[model samples]
Target: MHTQVAIIGAGPAGLLLSQLLQGAGIDCVVLERHDRAYVESRIRAGILEQITVDLLARVGVDARMRREGLPHDGFNLAVDGSTFRIDMTGLTAGSKVMVYGQTEVTHDLIEACLERNTPLVFEAQDVALHDIESDRPFVTFTKDGQARRLDCDFIAGCDGFHGVSRRSIPEERLAAFERVYPFGWLGILADVPPCGEELTYSNHERGFALASMRSPTRSRYYVQCGLDERLEDWPDERIWDELATRLGPEAASHMTRGPSIEKSIAPLRSFVCETMRHGRLFLAGDAAHIVPPTGAKGLNLAASDVAILSDALIRWYGEGEACGLDGYARRALARVWKAERFSWWFTGLTHRFPDMDSFARKMQLAELDYIRGSRAAQTTLAENYVGLPLA
Candidate 1:
C-alpha cells in the first residue's frame, strides 16, 4: 500500500495530522498498536490550550467539546494555606484554557476519522520505519497475522515515548536531555464536583497537590508521593485526607470526598529530544518531548507540533514549497524548549525536593511570594499557561 504520509500511532497527534492533511487533499494512513478501545480509554492530560481547541474546531471535531468542555479564565496557585488567582484572560488579552479530557479529544478525532473513511488501522504490531533518511520512506507492520508494507513520502512518529519512532533514528543523529523527579503524583478520579471553579496548584510543607477535573461532575485530584509509594498504601480515605490538608481549609470547605473510580501513581519527568525531524521522518508529541504536568503543556505542545507539521506538509504538496518542511525541526523545537523551561520552573516551585534544606524550601516560598505580588510574574505564567504562539 502507498500513501503520502504513513503515520504511526492513532493518538491525537497522528489523528489530528491526518485530518488536517486530508482536509488539504493529502492522503495518509494511521497505524496503532492498540485497539480503538485502548486508545480512547487512556486517561491523560485534561487541559487544552486555545491553540488545541482551535485546531479541534478547524477539523470539525469541536461540537461535543463546545457543549461539554469547561473554559476558565484563570487558575489558582496556593502556598501553604494562602491562595491567589492568576487571571490568564486579563493578563494575556482574553486568552483562556479549556478543561477537556485528552481521552475525549482522542475519541472525537477517531470518530471523525472513521466518519471520513480515513485509513486508520488498529492492532498494527511490529511497526517499523525504513529508509527515513531518503525521500522514499516506508513503514512495515503486521495486522491480523499478516505482514504488510506501506510506501510513503513521509512518516510521522506519534507512537509516544516507548514507541519505535525515536529509536529508528541513529543514536549519533540525536541528543537526549532528561530529568526524573524524586517524587510521583498519586492521583484519584471520583464522581464528584471539583473544589473550585478553576484548577489549583498547591504547595504545602507536606508536598505538592493539584485540584483538577475532567468535567463539572468528575473531579481529579493528586498529591505528591514518594517514588516508592504503592497504591495499597493510599486508600480513598487517606488520599482525601491528604488533599484536604494540603489544599487548605478554603478549598477543602467546598471539596467533596467520594470513592475513587481510578487511582495511579505517575512519576514526573522532563524529557526532550533535540531536532524533532530527520530526513523524511518527523517526530511529534511524546515521541519528541515530555514536560512535567505542572504547566499542562504535554498535549498542547503535541497539537502545536502537528499543526506546524500539517501546514508544512500542505505547503509542500500544494505550492511546491519545502521551506516549512526544511525548517520544521527548528520551529517546533523553539516552542518545545520554552514549554520545557516553564514546566521545569513550575515543578520546582511547587514540589518539595527530597534533598531540599531549609534554605531551598525558603527560596521556593520566596519565589511564590514574589509571583503573588508581581503582575509581571503573573503575566509570564498566564502567557505560558494559555499556550505560547506558534514559531
Candidate 2:
C-alpha cells in the first residue's frame, strides 16, 4: 500500500490531520492500535480553546458539538474559601471556550472519516517504520495475522506519549524533559448536575478540587490526592465530602452527588521533547509534549501542532513548498514551551504541596488575592486560557 502520508495512532491528532489532509486532496491512511469503540469511549480532557472549536467547525465535524457543547465565557478560581471569577470572553476581546468532551470530538471526527470513506485502519499491531530518513519511507504492521507494508513520503508520529511513535525516534537526537508532580488527581464522572455552569478550580487547606462537566447533567469532578493514593481509597461519599469542603459552602451547596459512572486517578506531569521532528517522522500531540491538565492545553496543542504540520504538508503537496515541514520543530516547540510554563504555573497555583512552607502557603494566597483584584493579571490569564495564535 502506498500513500502520501502514513499516520500512526488514530487519536485526535491523527484523526484531525487525516480530515484536514483529505480536504486538501492529500491521500493518507491512519493506523490505530485500538478498536473503534475503545477510541471513542476513553475519557479525556474536554476544555476546547477558541481556535480548536474554530478548526473543528472548519472541518465540518462540529455540528454535534455546536448543538450539545456548552459555551463558557468565564471560570472561577477559588483560594482558601473565597472564589473569584475570571471573565475570559470579556478580558480576551470576546473570545470564548467550549466545554465539550474530547471523546465526543473524536467520535465526530470518526463519523466524518467514515462518511467520507477515509482510510483509517484500527487494531493495527506491531507497527514499525523503516527508511524514514530517505525519500521513500514505509511502515510495516500486522492485521489479522497478515503482514502489511505501507509506503509514504512522510510519517506523522501522533501515537501519543506512551505509544510507539516517540520511542521510535533515536534517543541521542531527541532530548526529553519531564517533571512528575507529587500529587495526582482523583477524578469521578457522575450522572449529576454540575456545581456551576462555568468550571471552578479551588485551592484549599486540604488540597485542590475542580468542578467541571461534560454536559449540563454529566459532571466530572477532581480532587488532589497524594502521589501514593489509589482509586480504592476514594469512595463516592468521601470524594463528595472532599469536593464540598474544598469548593466551600457557596459552590458546594449547588453540587448534587450521584453514582459515579467512571472513576480514575491521573498523576500530574509536565513533559516536553526538545525536538518534534526527526527526518521524515514528525511528532504531534502527546508524542511531543504533555502539560498538567490544569491549563487544558494538551488537545489544543495537538490541534495546533497538526494544524502547522497539515499546512506544511498541504504546501508540499499542493504548492511544492517544504519550508513549513523544515521549520515544523522550531514552530511547534515555541508554542509548546509556552503551554508548558502555563500548566506548571497553574498547577503550582492551585495544588497543595506536602513540603510547602508557611511562607509559601502565604505567597500562594497573596498571588490569588492579587489575581482577583488586578485587571492586568486577569487579562494575561485570559489570553493564555483562550489560547495563543497558531501562527
Candidate 3:
C-alpha cells in the first residue's frame, strides 16, 4: 500500500494528525499496536489547553466536547492550610481551559476517523521505519498474522516514547535529556463531586496533592507517594485521608469520600529530544518530548506538535512550500521547551523533594506567598496555563 503519510500509533497525536491531514485532502494510514478498546480506555490527563480545543473543533470532532466538557476560568493553589485562585482567565485576558478527559478526546477522534473511512489499522505489530533519511520512506508491520508494507512520502512517529519511531533514527543523530523524579502520584478516581469548582494544586508539609475531576460527578484526586509505595498499602479510605490532610481543612470540608473506581501510581518525569525531525521521518507527542503532569502539558503538547506538523504538511502538499517542513523541528522545539520549563517549575514548587531541608520548604512557601501577592507572577502563570498562542 502507498500513502502520502504513514503514521505510526493511534494515540491522540496520531489520530488527530490523521484527521487533520485527511481534512486537508492528504491521505495517511494510522497503525496502532493496540486495539481500539485499549486505546479509548487508557486513562490520561483531562485538562485541554485552548489550542487543543480549537484544533479538535478545526477537525470537526468537538461537538461532544463543546457540549459536555467543563470550562474553567481559573484554578487554585494551597499552602499552609490556605488556598488562593490564579484567575487564569482574568490574568490572560479571558483565556481559559477545558476540563475534558483525554480518553473522550481519543474516542471522539477515533469515531471521526472511522466515520470518514480513514485508514486506521489497530493491532499492527512490529512496526518499523525504513530509509527515513531518504525522501522515499516506508513502514513495515505485521497485522492479522500477515506481513505488510506501506510506502509513503513521509512518516510520522506518534507511537509514543516506547514506540519504534524515535529509535529508528541513529543514536548519533539524537541527543536526549531527562529527569526522573524521586516520587510518584498515587491517584484515585471516584464517583464524587470535586471539592472545588476548579482544580486545586496543594503544597503540604507531608507532600503534594491535587484535586481534579473528569465530570461534575466523577472526581480524580492525587497525593504524592514514594517510588516504592504499593497499591496494597493504600486503600480507598487511606487515600482519602491523605488527600484530606494534604489538601487542608477548606477542601476537606466539602470533600466527598467514596469507593475508588480506579487507582494507580504514576511516576513523574521530564524528557525532551533536542530535535523532532529526522529526514522524512518526524516525531510528535511522547516520541519527541514528555513533561511532568503538574502543568497538564502532556496531551496538550502533543496537540501542539501535530497542529504545527499538519500545517507544515499541508503547506508542503498544497503549495509545494518546503519552509514549514524544513523548519518544523525548530518551531516545535521552541514551544516544547517553554512548556517543559513550566511543568518542571510547577512540579518543583509543589512536590516535596526527599532531601528538602527546612530552608527549602521555607523557600517554597515564600515563593508561593510572593505569587499570591504579585500580579506579574500570577499573569505569568495564567499565560502559560491558558496555553501560549501558536506562532
Candidate 4:
C-alpha cells in the first residue's frame, strides 16, 4: 500500500489527523494494534479546553459532544475545609471547558473517518517504520498473520507511550526529559450521579482527590495512591472512603456507592522529547510528550499537536512551502513547555511531596489561599485551564 501519509495509531491524535488531512484532499492510511471496539471504549480524559472544543466543532465532529457534553464556567479548589471557585468564564471573557472523554472524541473522529471512506487498518501488528530521512518513508506491519508494507511520503507517529515510533529515532539523536512522581491516581467511574456541578480538586493531608463526572448519570473520582498499588487492593468501600476523606467533610455525605464501570491507577509524570520531527517522521500526542492529569492537559495537548501538524502539511503540499513544516518542532514546543510547567505546578500544589517540609507545606497553602483570594491569580489558572490558542 502507498499513501501520502501513514498514521501509526487510531487514538484521538491519529484519527483527528486523518480527518483533517482528508478534509484538505490529502490521502492517508491509519494502522492500529488494537481492535476498533477496544480503541473506542477505552476510558481516558474528559475535559476539553476551549480551543479543543472549537477545533472539534470546526472539523464537524462535535455534534454529539455539543448535545451531551456538559459545559462548565470554572472549577473549585478545596483547602483548609473551604471551597474556592475560579470563574473561568469571567476570567477569559466567556471561554469555558466542556466535559467530553477522549474515548468519545476518538469514536467521533473514527466514525467520521469511516463515513468518508478513509483507510483504517485494525489489529495490525509487527509495525515498523523505516527510511525517515528519505522523501519516501514507509511502515511495515502484519495483518491476518501476513506481512505487508505501506509506503508513504510522511509518517505521523501517534502510537503513544508504549509505541515503537519514539524508539525508532536513533538513540544518539534523541534527548529525553522525564520526571516520575512518587504518587499516582486511583481513578474510578461509578454509575451514580456526580456530587458537584463543576470539578473539585482538593488538597489535604490524606492526599489529593478530584471530583469529576463522566455524564449526568455517571460520576468519576480519583484519589492519590502509591505507584505500585493494585486495583484489587482497593475494594469499592475503600475507594469511596478514600474519596470522602480527601474531598473533605462536606463532600462525604454527597458521595454514593454504585457499580464501577472502570477502575485503574495511573502514575503521574512529565515527559518531553527534545525534538518532535526527524525528516519524514513526525511525532504527535503521547508519542512526543506526556503531562500529569492534574491540569487535564493530556488530550488537549495532543489535539494541539495534530492541528499544528495538519496545517503545516497543508501549507507544504498546497502552496509549495516548506517553512511551516520546517519550523514544526519550534512552534509545537512553545505550547508544549507552557503546558508542562502548568501541569507540574498544579501537581505540586495538590500532591503531598515526599520532601515537603513544614515550611514548604505552609508556602503551598499560602499560594493556594492567594489564588482563591486574588482575581489575577484566578485569571491565570483559568487561562491555562481553558488552554492557550492553537498555534
Among residues 3 or more apart in sequence or in different chains, the pairs in candidate 4 whose N, CA or C atoms overlap within 3 Å are none
Sorted on lDDT, highest at the top, how do the candidates line up?
A: 1, 3, 2, 4
Candidate 4: which stretches are off by over 4 Å? none
Question: Model 2 Cα RMSD, Å?
Answer: 0.8
- For candidate 4, what is the lDDT? 0.91
For all predicted structures, in order, the TM-scores are 0.99, 0.99, 0.99, 0.98
Of 3 and 4, which scores higher on lDDT? 3
Tens digits of per-residue lDDT for model 2, 1-391: 9999999999999999999999999999999989999999999999999889988987899999999999999999988778889999899889989999999999999999999999999999999989877899899999998999999999999999998878888788888999999999999999999989999999999999999999999999999998788788888999999999999898888999998999999999999997788889999999889999999999999999999999999999888888989999888988899989999999999989989999999999999899999999999998999899865
Model 3 residue 100 CA deviation (Å) reads 0.1
338 Cα displacement, candidate 4 (Å): 0.2
Q: How would you encode candidate 3's per-residue C-alpha lDDT over 1-391 as one tens digit per residue?
A: 9999999999999999999999999999999999999999999999999999999999999999999999999999999579999999889888999999999999999999999999999999989899998989999999999999999999999999888999999999998899999999998999999998999999999999999999999999999999999999999999999999999999999899999989999999999997689899999999999999999999999999999999999999999999999989888888999999999999999989999999999999999999999999999999998888776
- In candidate 2, residue 217 scores what lDDT? 91
Model 2: worst 10 consecutive residues (lDDT sum): 164-173
Q: What do the candidate models score in CA lDDT, each in turn?
A: 0.95, 0.92, 0.95, 0.91
lDDT tens per residue, model 1, 73-103: 9999999979999999999999999999999
Top candidate, metric lDDT: 1
